[model samples]
Target: MHHAMRQPLPKPTPANLRRFAETPVARKAINTIKDQIAGMRWRIQRRDGNAPAATSDVRIHILAANLDAPNPDDSFRSLTEQVIEDVLVGGWGAVEVQLTSDPQRPLLLWPVDGATIRIYAGWSGDAEEPRYAQVTPWGRHVDLRNDELVYVRLNPRSHTPFGLGRLEVAFETISWLLGAQDYAARLASNTVVQYALWLAEMPPASYDKVISWWQNEIEGTGKVPIIANLPAKPEVLRFGEGSDRDLRLEWQRFLIRIIANAFDLPPLLLGLEQDVNRSTAGPLLEEAFRTAVVPTARLYAEHITREILGRRLGWNDLEFVFEDLEIFDERAQAEIDEILLRNDVLLPDEVRLRRSLPALPGGWGGLTYTQRQMLIGGQRSATGDQ
Candidate 1:
């Protein structure tokens, strides 16, 4: 049913105020179309032999999830999509893997016929017991890798939990794909249309499938992808002047706007509503931001856009400021200076608690669990138990 509540939002543009026979619109307000062209131009401008090409003989895919409370299943649709097209097919671009599930359900979307391989990499809370931490190919998977190999990350006395750790591992691999010079030149040289279309063509891959695709994409390529390790273990709630600080405040405001329109919900609830739009927290008044806060904000945004807004945005009255997109960083100094020197306001990335970890997975010999834990612990027993 076509519900007529709000008009679709104007396509995000640098300029929304069109000049009438009498009114003069500034160049910045209506430049979204041109901005896209410029961005595409930028991509083309950077194209070189070191970059890498989107086309590939062997394609791969990847996916991952993250959560406040550890859940075995976290929907990895977005991550997986990048894996198939970006890394496997496009052979370029960056992807983030998280273990956070949308509403406490498992993320089941990979291991298909065309892509049968599965490479599992995650944190299971314990390297020893499945009860403390278990990895399953049964919940919702094709088990394409067909190997019962599960990577377990034991929880330490002080830790953030296994879910986040898994996310890190997932991203490390994604970076390796983006940074590999074997295709770097081609990747850097890709046209904007190529990258955008590459992004659009990616299939919604499952977690298990991503691992396989990533592995195969790099196999026998001479240079092995690196899997960077998380110095120690995950630490939850390191509240202070953290990353995404500004983004969180703005996100909180966004949540409030959402709630003001919906049922009676506090800013915090809407802010942390990815899991339950129905409760409260303890130290909710901390001035600084939290890691969970950023992920939760992303979840809320995705859910609303994917589940609610889909394609039903009001473009007439609502003029989306293209500058709002966090990733769009191609701005002129004069423009940034004008907005900042006078406005004194910060941009999204500036305010958020974002931290870019070293790109790519650990170097070759990075280890499948069978390989990583080989000598660190003990010799392999007859029962296949370390």
Candidate 2:
């Protein structure tokens, strides 16, 4: 008989640790973070600082419609959600745009997994253009040019061309938190008890029989009460006098806060609402969106605008814009709108559109009244009152 030599196992690198950190439980947390970021409303707007068109321009409509319906089955919203998820987990998200026979129109927008797509910098004759190689399902590599792929990277490292995900930093803490949860669950399900059984002056055979009976009846079902014959007593003791479970719960919560901080998320956003109240919750929500969600949204917008809409489709002025968060005070917005309307900055129809109301009858809605007229009217009213 002959023995074959065994290959040595590979050392655990940062990439390997990152891959390991993407366990089922970790993936659930990542999804939650991504969902919160992607829940924001997004739209296509002109980069020339003009108002969004009443009727979308033909080029804008085609692009927006394609993004809204990336495929026959998927929408742009869902695609963006997944892209953010990938970017958070792997530090990059990429989408492939397939053009129609007419280069101006896009046929499909397909999301490519960041993990499967390998980016090779300086592969093309142009130093700025990075070549992409996507691994197909059949184990072959499909090369994609820069115009065909929209790649968004987060937190790129100094040396490596690739970006670094937050998971790489928080992996150990998240792993520990998940492990602690599993441990706590196990302890809750299978509580520990110290027991002492005493046999006083009992015969050897009878003692054995009693012990066997106790094992079968009491330990097996956990329903039967401990019973002993004459001169025998069974005592079940509590493991600890202190509240260890409470301490464990506190530790778990502390770990959760650490994980949230690593991802730049508010603990309240992750359902840890202990210290949050009406006053603090609003600020926390705003802070979370401003710090985390807004940056991610901006990254996506810039990449999509420059890569897909600007370069590929030749729509240089077309850009993606996320709607202002609805967390603002309606009263404040109304006051500002009124001022703008009086100053002739915004037409009546513009204000009406903002309020989701139909325009006034005929073209009267488009007329803008000046602040001078308002001031004159106020003077007349004051004189008439006197």
Candidate 3:
């Protein structure tokens, strides 16, 4: 007998990962990371001094406005949300940047489906060179140059041009979870009987009568009392231990935790707070920001700066940044501010500005505590002489 070698199954693609992401726990994990990244406040700043503008260039204003509102159809926040979702599900986020003749809005950004993007071979390590193309639904390929699009990867790999998505990491787990959920749904839909009524020493006609009464009358009625005067007493026989313990819910919960871990999110955010306490909750959120939000936000900002700001527009001095990436701890920030003030690292007016407060009247607010005391002492001495 000749033995036939079996061919290996195809590896999971972005579309397969996206289909798995539609599961409840997987979707929650992806959306949690997406919200954290997309909700951040982004800005364009100069690299030389980190100022709002490097010079009196009109291009800065035009670029800022274009970034704020990519086009009339899409806002920056909405586009970012969709792009981050794509990155989380597909490991790639792409946006086609079309240059417009309008002076006010010179660039129009349209999000390209990451799943449809195909990277061509024979690509050298040139950032400005074109290497990608988009495959249309009708089987047409549209070339996307490197400078014409902003493409970001979640976890870039040297072996392959594609990145590794979080969903891909937990694909098998999510598949098992979905299967378990489907089984539970089947149980809930009365595919299996939980309890059956056994009438001992009853005629066939009487058993049929009782079953008919149950199917026709008792099934749809909401918990109404049943006063049955049957020939034999009915014995209740339970099939298994119980539905609560039989569905393997603990297994499902374990799968949810695995999916959350793959996305670098706390299980609490994915609706699993069983092990969480008050003391750990705050720290868990901070850890999430550090692990999940910061990396993705920084990657997004870097790509925007490199592709859109620097390469496309030739604005090498300007870069993109997300202002609100840090998890804001009011008490910790206040303590740091006090330490800075005591050490004369920051002036009172500078601290006020940092807190978004109006500066104090006159130049007094600019002075440190020691300087203010010395100025008051000099003023008092002059007043005594006068």
TM-score on alpha carbons, each prediction: 0.16, 0.75, 0.78
- List, residue by residue over 236-345, the lDDT tens digit for candidate 2: 45544445562268877887787777677788766688977899998887787777776777788789888878877788887876655433456877788889887788
List the candidates ranked by TM-score, beginning with the highest: 3, 2, 1
Clashing pairs in 3: none
lDDT string for model 1 (1-386, tens) is 01111324333111211111011111111121122222221011011211112111011011112211112332333322322222111112122112224433222222221112223445343424222212243555422221122111211223432212211222222222222322334323431111111223334443334445344644335466543332322222322343344123443344233422221222343333433322334333221122222222233234323321222221121111112233333355436644653343432222221121122233312223334455545555534762
Residue-pair clashes per candidate, as listed? 66, 0, 0
Structure candidate 2, residue pairs in collision: none
Q: With candidate 3 superimposed using the best TM-score fit, by how many Å does residue 370's alpha carbon deviate from the native?
A: 8.7
Report the Cα lDDT for residue 359, model 2.
Answer: 66
Winner on lDDT (1 vs 3): 3
Listed per candidate, the RMSD to the true structure in angstroms reads: 33.9, 7.0, 6.1
Please give, for residues 1-386, the per-residue lDDT of candidate 3 as tens digits.
Answer: 00111323235776677677787788888887888777776656567542222334576667778888997888898899888888888788999888888878878899888989888778785866668889887999887777887888989989998887788787877777777777777677767567898888877878877887776666656466474777787677887787577676898899888888889988899898887899999999888888988898898899988898788878788788786665257788789878988776777765554343556778666678788888889999999999
Computed on alpha carbons, the lDDT of every model, listed in order, comes to: 0.26, 0.68, 0.77
What is residue 317's positional error in candidate 1, in angstroms?
A: 23
* CA error at residue 179 for candidate 1, angstroms: 37
